[model samples]
Target: MAKTKEAAMRTKNLRGIVRLSALAGLAVGGLALAQEAPDRGIVHVGGDLYRAHNNAHNTVFLVTSEGIIVSDPINRDFAEWLQGELASMYDVPVRVVAYSHHHWDHASGGEVFADTAEVIGHETMPGALALPSGDTPLSDAAAALDANGNGQIEQSEASGNLAGQFALIDADGNGMLTGAEIARGPVSDVYPPSTVYSDTRTVTLGGKSVELIHVAAAHSPDMTVLRFPDEDAAFFVDIISLKRLPFMDFPGLEDVDSLIGTIQAVEAIDFSIGVGGHGDIGTKQDVADHRGYIEALRDAVAAGIADGQSLEELQASITMDEYSDWGSFNWLPNNIAGMYRILGGGN
Candidate 1:
């Protein structure tokens, strides 16, 4: 009963009016929102390894005799909350903040820790986090966004998620957004890493270590997978979910082949347990099953296209009942359509 009520508060916390509309059109939903998950909690994954929760999002941290190594602070509110818990429960401060990727949801609140922690990420993170200078010309898409041709995006000119974030991103409170402000991406408070690495780099803190492996462009170009050998666990985000269907119906997946291969890569890593940015914990076998689901969906969609079936027929025909017991299985239709478009079939 206690757990149930706390979860209700977490759900309520995530249902802000501004957040609801900004994420309304987002693709990562099979249900209403992550608000349905939980408010927050800390779970023990292994010796000295803990998983932090914020509604549907999760991050990991390792506590050692020296200090703590944390990954993906998640967001400002969650980070602040987690920091308070750390201060109360443990004597050590967070010595390192490791990013899984540059996506705002997982990385936004990192600034809270960066004042003291050595934040680190793949070499590409700087590029992902960089805001354009005033003189920087807008991409065709961004330029077109300047509907009034005033070289800036006004509140009225913005729509969708951009409209929702307009007031917040409009620095100087001028009710106007320059190309630089427009480049701030969807979320804010994403502090750039104090340390960046081009290839694999081992972060040793307080006698514990986490190896950041720069992975291929599966989800985000700057994605990193943190391997905690001492803890015998791995932590990742978005690239794969443990035992859950793809988020946002696997939105923007043009290279299904590459993503499946990336899952295979994850399976080969040395870890008994795996924690993702969302959903349940996983293992290598679970990773393999994840690969299987994508492979099955892709093959089904490709075969249907070859057979001249319409997108509706493909969606109707491919139920993926093998994974019917999986979480978010209701999103199978959206997943099917996503593959259909990827295979050069559906609109």
Candidate 2:
């Protein structure tokens, strides 16, 4: 009886282990399916132009006549989705991709479109990418978790694989980066652009004129805004987004007032519509809203300085609740800090 009882217990334990294994397998399969699902939030803007909000940090623009032009491709998954969407709209291939700045959220995904499309950026963009200050935490974690363990992080990782995606910078010089390192780098993937412009450049595709305008540093030193004059549509990449806070961690914060002025300069130009790097395409009001947010933050920081408040105090006191609903809130705190630094306080 004792032997029979012991055998029965062992059999029951084996069954339990098998059941657990099956459950684990099912869970993993479900996750894989979720990852492989089709892209959501792809929308049409009028006449051959499509805008896709891949998530919070990337926005892609597709022009059927002239192929596709992306403001900032955040990751490989997003890049793939963008390409697929363009293909669905136009039989022709994507011709060009323009980087808003050298930041990873705007540039890392270039590998996806880089192979086929002409990846373009400002004259200083290549140098910025080579520097080690534009990495992000979410990117680092994803890189660590990739199947092959390469340092390249993808969008899927930023969305689900990781708990939160935070902008990070790399202070250390090691080629292998930590999440912190990625957040600190100025730009990643510094490939030579097919075309580099100092002030402005124009490319005509399918009889449509696409103008790449270099707006003086508001978010980053090499910020570029793309305009489709005939379409009356403009893409203000990184300068603004829908619900998230704009990132102001670049070197241009010293001239916050000038940055706002530069944005106003763009506003003076007549354009019926504008698209941000991370949000929906809308009227010039979108541009004005972004400017307002920046101007408000600058004023708040300046007020804090007048009050003799420390950097930490200023950061805590300034609130972006009015603009919180705008995309990129994850990056707002950093923007505040950047402003504080520009105002002569360091933390």
Candidate 3:
């Protein structure tokens, strides 16, 4: 499909440049908002790390004597805006563009800093970006849009980033969307990480350090939980949005047990501040709370399944009212649907 070709070309081009730069003397490297809020600004996370936000979505960056390290471009415009901000605010160019995952909402617009930064991610990112076969998992929200239950998402069914992008994302112009198309969403282009790593890897510049931990996650297998030791802060994208209820069905979610494991992996990291891809800044306890929320949800859904309750029945039976104070509390229904699907509820 056209999406596959375009993605391959971008990855290939980046690899070529990175290789050439390495031989030439070693080279360089490299938003979304929640609530549809347009608020934008930068605040210190601690030490050399700072978070720049555009409404509900935010990205963390590290600045050092050598250069700057950034995560997620959010979108083309957001990237462009951030690039200009970096230029005016810092002497060094962006040297690294680290992705928390391959999700278009968090990882797109990387081209904005491609000239001066190295794109990096978990090794599995390249495979996830490939135009997927029909087997790609869908978030409950996205699946609901497949009104007819057909594998393909039609233009009329589209909303949010996929709306009006039917032509571009369709790739083959077949008036249908594959998992790849819907996943790519509204992004014009996404550059796969040229410098990929597995398990754990650390990127150092000047005198600062940033660590990336890859783990199995329901959101995306490519999830990279970032830890900035210097700042005592960690950046975990959609895998953990502290203080906020899980997004509609958390598209791409698959296994409950594995997702819990993913959270445990994050807990092992030693960071006081937890900077989620969305929501406000949080604390280490927030990470615990984050994990506890999932654990609670998993237990509820498992019991419902054991009782042979329907998805709707479980939704009503488990209000998750204890979390009513959290943002997007009403998404409990969709959240239940996802937990149900993964728990063998056959949602």
Candidate 4:
């Protein structure tokens, strides 16, 4: 019986991996095309669901007979193109604009859908929107990034220093940026959701049902998991980066315990496949492993703290060598330092 149970577990894991591979083909392809412009790529994920792979992030949309529901407009131009696609392909007006979180890169162009769509997000989203803007003035950052000193920010010039800032620098209507536009600087538009929910909000648009489950103060105060029960697909951002290391600053987590619990909770839900805000597709096993990664890091840091190690000592001692081949090894130290602070009760 024990052998049979072990075999069954292996089979379950294999089945999950196979399903993940099938649903994640485009998701992997989407990563290779990350260099392409935001409007350049659109991935159709069976039925009425589709994902647009933008420069830095992805915007997912579902088309039902009643109307359309989209998550994250990315930016103005990306949203305009997404809106245009819906018009051209399905000819259905947008009924809802759902935000996964309140980060500028993901939710900025929500105003584009304001005419027809009812924007919805977590209750904490408004507070994030109300925070001070991080946009740097064009003149202030231009001299540093404008290589030619031509009073404009060219793609070549911006390439070196402004990798993460391109989504904000495109002031002109054209998708590409120019030195002149760079001179204008970064921009931020906050479109707060008209509808806010505390825990979960289930909306049946057209014929499909999606659950926006709030995992607050994890990646952000308003991070939401967009779950499609019928499709068995869930979209989560920041906490799980698939095979890659998280983006930056300990994956920008506010609470480590909350993040771990959230991942475990998501794993318990009925989902065949999952996708992050910024990487390849994921499986239940992937989410479990990510949780393990965090737990292991926490334990390692906790042990170090118990040993009375210094922050720098902990950083050197607690190397997550198992995940050394992951995307962002440089940020491992940052993760350790942050975890040390959390486990050590340091301010």
Candidate 5:
């Protein structure tokens, strides 16, 4: 009877926590909708180059001569909105769509551009695609997300949602999740990149030199940063988002120190404007802020582990109060959880 009562209490507490989380999400969502659009996302920063923000998860880039080369599309709705924006802003068609990694927020809406432009990413992009098409174990795990045994998983279903449906699968088919798989599930829905590069690739489009730089894992193993040397602008995908909390979605956090070091390593490259996978256009200060934020969270999680705090406790205790004024507080919880796992050596 005591055991039964204890279990019942625990269940009740869990329910309360879920309810609180839902309410908090609603509050944040409301604020996001109410807030005015940032000037950075909509305004043109330089010659024929424009950056636009869709919610808190994607950044769309428009280049006059090259058409459009977006970092991540985030979702169908946002992708549609972006398409319309591009149509209005420029007369040319979108030529290339790029994914920083395989995460849905960064890659899902690639299908929208598939019929138009050539999609490109790291060489692992096709492997990412294979995972979601149910071609691998990770894709199988994601396909198994239909917990209700429903024949079809709709967007509205809990386990059927976009994020739920694309759960990472074991990439190697070795019955074990690799670091890359943990950080970025196989790409789904989006068309696999026609061009995938393991190292660096530089191409000239509309007279602008676009350099694709593959950095060591900070956000995802397949992550790559795009630089427009002539434009004096570089787009770093999920390695960092604007004032938004950093997401540790991939298993790459195990190499957080190296990730930070890699970012600093690129600092010597002269660039005027820096664009992220999420949030608005920024300066070098934004990059420093992200580095500092990740370092602080790493330290906090490490301290929690030393203090004998459970993962659950550590996650609940780590707040984004310091970054509350940042554009996307809604993403903090997930970011915190990712950091906790990385620091606790779970990844």
Candidate 6:
């Protein structure tokens, strides 16, 4: 009887423990459900300028009396989200949608604003948009984004490898990859700029003026800096990250000379705060720091080249260990190679 009672007691304890564990699991699940997704909130940077940050990408807008002028919608969902957010907060329509550069990450989803807003970009933007992202053909990209092998590209299949190649196949930003979209062909996330400018275009609206300056080919051939003189703030996308080291040679840094010049020019401007395409708001010091990093890398590469260091030698020997604490330390070798190619013998 004693043994039987002991076994029953152990069983009771086990049941109680199981019950507690189940309750704990439920509690954990509830907490998880309650926890919200990362809020890509619109940060008001004083005056009419506001920043709509989604994921790592940023789109800045100016609340004008006529309507809103936004830059770099990022993607379709983000564009829709921004539209909705604007609708909720303000009664104005989006008047102008501007492309910071021709890069897809910043240039996509402008079609959403096409009907209402005038899409603007640098003159070189159209040619850049027409070019292929890589060597991959349109048909191959379409096949890759076909995901289900259903011979039809549906939105459901927009995951995995398809997501990356979708921009290459989805000619129309209609969320569907149909033969119609494919027939349009030469797929790209970049929409044709309705308004183009060479150097500077000053936009005056709602008692505010936005000075659009074609800074340099720092990030792309047609990188435009949006300067709000009244607010003393400028949005310099892709070229300068406030805190981070930047993504892999700073993503198509073709002209380091132009970059340096652009930085100096921006520093000369009376702006106090700046917004980069892919990071937090930048102080004047952040801009200077970024310029310093670029200068140092250039100097390092120049020194290596002067020492007759080959690509391999430079890759192995050169190091930016001083920037070890920076965002993309792993990209140092790549940065070194890019600098070598640009500054050294490589074309």
Residues 1-347, candidate 1: write the lDDT tens digits. Answer: 12245433433443343465446535444545533434899999998899989988999999988888999988777898999999999998988999999987789767678666889988999888776677756556767888779887776677755676654455344667777776766544576788999879998877888899888888888889999998889998988888889875678678998898777777778998999888789787887878888888888888999999999898888888888888888888888878888889954
lDDT of 2 at 236: 75
Ranking by lDDT: 1, 3, 6, 4, 2, 5
Best candidate (score: TM-score): 1
Candidate 5 residue runs with Cα over 4 Å from true position = 1-41, 132-186, 248-252, 265-268, 307-324, 328-338, 345-347
Clashing pairs in 5: 128-187, 138-169, 138-170, 183-250, 183-251
Alpha carbon lDDT of each predicted model: 0.79, 0.63, 0.78, 0.70, 0.62, 0.73
By lDDT, is 2 or 4 better?
Answer: 4
Whole-structure CA lDDT of model 2 = 0.63
Let me know the TM-score candidate 4 reaches against the reference structure: 0.68
| Cα deviation of 95, candidate 2, in Å | 1.7
What ranking emerges by TM-score with the best candidate at the front?
1, 3, 6, 4, 5, 2
Clashing pairs in 6: none
lDDT of 3 at 258: 74
Better of 1 and 3 by TM-score: 1
lDDT of candidate 3 over 41-123, digit per residue (tens): 89988888899987678999999999999998886558889999999999999999999988767887787687788899899
After superposing candidate 3 on the true structure, give the runs of residues whose Cα lies further than 4 Å from its correct spot: 1-37, 132-163, 167-188
State the lDDT of candidate 6 residue by residue for 235-311, as single tens digits. Answer: 98877877766667544556688878988877776788899887778788989988898899888888878887787
Quantify how close model 1 is to the true structure by its C-alpha RMSD in Å.
Answer: 7.6
Q: What is the lDDT, from 0 to 100, of the residue 109 in candidate 6? A: 67
Off by over 4 Å in 6: 1-39, 131-163, 170-187, 308-325, 345-347
Output the worst ten-in-a-row residue range by lDDT, candidate 3. Answer: 26-35
